[model samples]
Target: MKLFLYVLSLVGFLAGCGGGGVDSIADGDPSYVKVRESLREASSRVLDGLRIRGSYQAEDVFHVSGCESDSKEGGGKLWEAAHFWQIDEVNSGEVQSSIDRLRDSLEAQGWTIVDFARPPQVKNTVVRAQDPKAGYVVRVIGVQEKSRVAVRVSAPCFRASGDS
Candidate 1:
């Protein structure tokens, strides 16, 4: 009985790994293009605060097959919309200052800082911010040794444009 109970508890815990649970509901969006554009614009605002500018290349990853209803019957299979820009040509020396500007920018744009870690605090540096009202998230990741940065903007769980 103990082992069965342990397995059940573990299952419950694992369900929330990537922002799951009862509230993990997907929003309905009619236009996929609009959702894509909006997320890109939001990401650009975060980069606008950075002290350094690098090439912005969109990943164009639409239809991320995870955003779905957390209902008991699992009626719909929704997907998360996400856009990513990889900034190249940024050097390691500029990372620190860039992050500083990034933080200020995030605040100016009304984003709540979700996670932040830098050198001396930890080896790798990553910044995550979220727009509560808009349900959009932005993440900045940089590795000193790599000399490149990646920025990602993701929309909340949304059904495919077809569902509209």
Candidate 2:
């Protein structure tokens, strides 16, 4: 009986580690599917016109605000969905133009450009945007050394504490 109980407890703990068994849309959960789809759509806009050279990754994550009272008891917590698309290689000369186009598109869609940095001061060109109403942010990092560009879009978090 003791061994049986121990094995059961172990299984339960492992399951919880995988997000309470609500891993992804492929898990057949309708709500998860919707959230994943929405995040993908938002992220795709950021990668528009970019040639994908490497792998793409997307997932749901719990963001910790460092206000967690017990850290385990959940003092501060937010749930988010995000996606990233990485480009194979960036053309050295076209970095500026690419950033310009991305900035224009994001601005046209009502996203506010928070920060944009170019070469000389920084080796990589970076663009960050935020949507106040939607509560999401997007970042585009152009790595000159790696000759790659990565576009990431993160959804507005759902606070666990119910605080706005």
Candidate 3:
């Protein structure tokens, strides 16, 4: 896990700094199929940063969100691609470590860390980061009661795969 984190962080950093290396996550006017693939890959890359001792499940791959109420410039409804990867029910400390690693990885990849809150007292917290170019964001949550971690990657609003 440490090695994966180190490598991912480095790759992310380079990608963010215009390297456009293997970890770069940017797509413009992507179709539904393209967005789904991107979202799944993004979510998996994020899950790779976790240092969970136990295993987690990503059986569903990704969850498709309803289209936005408003349309884009061309008047076509927008779609959202997102998914949640839940940790294997670890302790608070482990969950925190995972969150830290996730934040580091995203920052390294060139995404902007917009919001991060893990107040010592607050068990339920979130860390949000966005791809400066595409505006896609990843949200990491620490569930207090479950003592687990859940990471969500949400792609920017996009048109249907077959549209345009």
Candidate 4:
């Protein structure tokens, strides 16, 4: 009876230790999707305003900025974590002005600006806009207690024809 109990206990322990049985969560969740959609909508609005002001251009790529990092947590290491957008730009002042309007627009949409800084990885230029330009990331916690969802949007400035 003692040997049998020991065997049963070992089996129970082995079963309990199997992979934790937790559901793997997808990185892209609904909240993140919604945030991304909202940002795209906001981008469209900015673009429309720029167009109305005669600054829209087809060559521009609205750069959304974020971060990458490697750090250890628990027994594992986290490879990357994107920060947020930090700037916006266009070939004309009208596009820049439209992006400037984003501060209020995002706030109204339930996002709070945590902070801002010029990313060092980018080469700052008086004429050309930096890559991963300027903007902010909006975040929401997921259904899982530790998960997060975010959307980043950025716009970088470019030179007009006359300026050197």
Candidate 5:
């Protein structure tokens, strides 16, 4: 009975490893929610008042910096984290228009446009911005031909304590 109980406890502890239940990607981010809200607001204007398409998000907790996670499920030491959103099913012409509107909107709000790119091989119109305080970075990419767009809002890098 004692051996069985010990094995059960060990299994339970090991089962918790590499799981998202250990810690959330946004656990210590105080401005995470607010930044997301700002992203939606800025994107909605360019998207014709429509909210984030698909509402899809990809978040991961990194145990080590500048390296990939060991597990495919994306759990690590919780050192770094990121979230992304993708929008599709838009008109190509509208994609350009939306990107222009978003660029102007961001500029008007004091966000400095750091980079703009239109690669010949790729159809995506890309825009990158940094806040005045440098607290966050925002990226917007739109493929006019495919009518697809993606936005990524990232928080400042910080050390995680490996605690939930």
Candidate 6:
């Protein structure tokens, strides 16, 4: 009888821990939510003027410094978009022109043009469409210092049938 009671108590304790454990729910971090909202807002602005065949998907990740130390540490993912382009016969100048057009459009909306590269990297997500059937992805990172808001924009390159 004593052994049975001991076993029951152990089981109950384990069950309770599992139900109310720290890992059960997220930390409810406000920073993450803030970053996400900011990304959504920025992405909407960036995509305002563009020829996209479909909708855009923007994902953002935020990192904060000084959380563990004296200095502030932070990182984030802004936005991503998919586009289709012809790869067989596109020239560099044409691609540049397209990018320039997009850049100008974005800038007109008050987005700061940080850097433009042929093949975008962590710092840049813009890609030149080289294949007719192939598509390019674009990503942009920007921040609204006032609200500590950041955004990354990415989209695929879509070329008209006769355009490319």
C-alpha local distance difference test of each model: 0.62, 0.55, 0.63, 0.29, 0.50, 0.31
Best by TM-score: 1
- Tens-place lDDT digits, model 6, residues 84-134: 111112232343344556567765644555556643344322522211222
lDDT comparing candidate 2 with the true structure: 0.55
Q: Model 1, residue 47: what's the lDDT?
A: 59
Tell me the tens digit of each residue's lDDT in model 2 across 1-164.
22332333234323332233232222233443454456556655665634333423222232212222223445434345455445545666565667778888888888899999888888788899997778678888887777667666666654332222
Superior candidate under TM-score, 3 versus 4 = 3
Candidate 2 lowest-lDDT run of ten: 59-68
Tens digit per residue, CA lDDT, model 3, 40-68: 56766677766565446433244444456
Count of backbone clashes for each model?
A: 0, 1, 7, 11, 1, 32
Q: Which segments of candidate 1 are over 4 A away from where they belong?
A: 1-30, 55-63, 68-75
Q: What is candidate 1's lDDT per residue for 1-164, written digit by digit as tens?
A: 22332333234323332233343323333454466557646655755667575544333233344565533445455656666556667877887678777977887778899999888898767888888888898888876777777777788865544443
The residue-by-residue lDDT of candidate 4 on 1-164, one tens digit each, is: 22332333234323332121122112243332333344454444333322322212222222221213323233322211121212223333332233334434544555554532221432221111112223334321111121111123332211111111
Residue 147 accuracy (lDDT) in model 3 = 78
Q: Please identify which of the two predictions, 1 or 3, would achieve the higher TM-score against the true structure.
A: 1
Q: Candidate 4: lDDT of 92?
A: 34
Cand. 4 Cα-lDDT: 0.29
Query: Against the true structure, what is each candidate's TM-score?
Result: 0.70, 0.62, 0.69, 0.28, 0.54, 0.34
Weakest lDDT window of 10 consecutive positions for candidate 3: 17-26
Q: What value does the lDDT take at residue 16 in candidate 1?
A: 32
> Residue by residue across 1-164, what tens digits does model 5's lDDT show?
22332333234323332233434334234433343334344433334422234322222112213223223344434233333445667665666666677777778878888987765755678888877774556678886666677766555544333422
Worst 10 residues of 1 by lDDT: 1-10
State the TM-score for model 3: 0.69
